[model samples]
Target: MRGNILQKSFIALQWKTSFTSQYLVAPTQVIKSMNVGNIRFIADAKNSGSKLEATVFQDDHHRDGRWWNISTEWKVACSFVVAVTSFFLNARYERIQVQKEIKLNRIQSQIKDLYGPLYGNRLVSDTSYRAVMKSHKGLKKYLSEARRKKDAEMIHCWRSYVWNVLYPLDKAAVDLILNNAHLIAQGEFPKEFEQLLMHAARMEFVMESWKNDDGALESAKRFDDDDYLEVSNASGLIFRTQILTHVKQKYDTLRDEQKQILLDISSDKQADDILAKIYQKVTHQDL
Candidate 1:
């Protein structure tokens, strides 16, 4: 009886050991991850407090979702900031460019008033005119350099008027000038046309000496330097010649009424009217 009781107690002890070990030991291969529940909890959780704390430990999806939201908000804010900054910068740039163009046009008008497009005739003090002309030319070069550096859109604004003025002698511009002159001088040249004629004649007379072969070569050579290349070069002469010649031809072809207007424009000495007429004669486009 004693031996049977001892044997039974030993059997019970073995079963308890086996059961405890089985409870502690994990399966050889994992059927599902323990973290899967935590992941689902964060993904589907709607409660803010539980999501904020418990979801913090979840996979990148939850963490990244939050980060993405914050990032998106920042990106939107940054976009708005950039847009406002661009608006002010563009406005300031436009204001500056417009002011520059206006200043240049004003200076050009003043120059016409002073010289009436004649080289020797002086209206303003030489110093004043020269100063203004220098400014105009300098500003033009500045704007051009800026455009070359990628500020073209800003500098040009609605149109390329700056580009047009800077390159007045370009083929297209020249064509425009000639065509305008023809129209303005169409029927009976205006007094403005007469003034244009006088100006053309004077220029022709002044440039006559440069037409001499010996003098031509010398004058051409003088234009080789940067300073002289602008207005004194052979190419410049040719360009001006074409313009003046066209104006003269147009003037000569004008009808009787146009001719009378030209005479009156010349004799009146009114700079504004004279220039307006000259502009019409030269470019056809209203200033």
Candidate 2:
């Protein structure tokens, strides 16, 4: 019975040692395999993270390039607008300057036409005199023909010549004759003196007839009744010429006493007043 008990105890101890070794060895192998799998998973996760970062960097680079292109286009558009506006403004300024020049040229041309060539020369020579006489004769012939034909248009056309040319000539002739009265008394006359006298007589007759004409008389009456005082250059010239002619004619007819009174008048205003009185006295009407 003691031998059987010793053998059974040894078998029990062997069984316990075998069971402990099996369990411990299986757990150690499983832990090693799980560690290897975990290491592979960590490596794969690192690779995926690197790929995502590269993609994000590429996207940022593309956006930057697009923004740079847009900025370049905006600059180009601004430059184009400035260029067009500058060109337009410069063209407009040039056009205005051209128009101003044209207007100035027109005004100069008008002035040259109206007051140059004949009247602009201060010294009158024999050639100028002949030219003037020829012009006057032609104008007179034209005027007479127009009147004979009762051509209203032709008469209207001659109005400027009648005032600017014929009237001025008449005034000049009257002045020459009055100034050279002593030479005339000595039986000396200027060149074309007879022609001037003839013209003067014709002008006097024409003026008298015109003043008495129905239309002229009515116009004169209306002009006299108006209170307007504006004086044109032409009208002022005519008035001055008439006053001088009247004064010269009256002076020639004055007595020695009246002439002495006129000579003694110191100021132009006093002389004009005395002459006006003399005119009233001689004409039996206020002058």
lDDT of each: 0.40, 0.42
What digit string (tens of lDDT, one per residue) describes model 1 on residues 27-94?
23212223521321112122222211112234444446778889999999998999999899869966
Question: In model 1, where do residues sit more than 4 Å from their true spots?
Answer: 1-68, 116-119, 122-287
Worst 10 residues of 1 by lDDT: 47-56
RMSD of 2: 35.3
- Per-residue lDDT tens digits for candidate 2, residues 187-286, read 4553334554565565555444324346342222232311122121113222222333433343343333334434443354475689889968988863
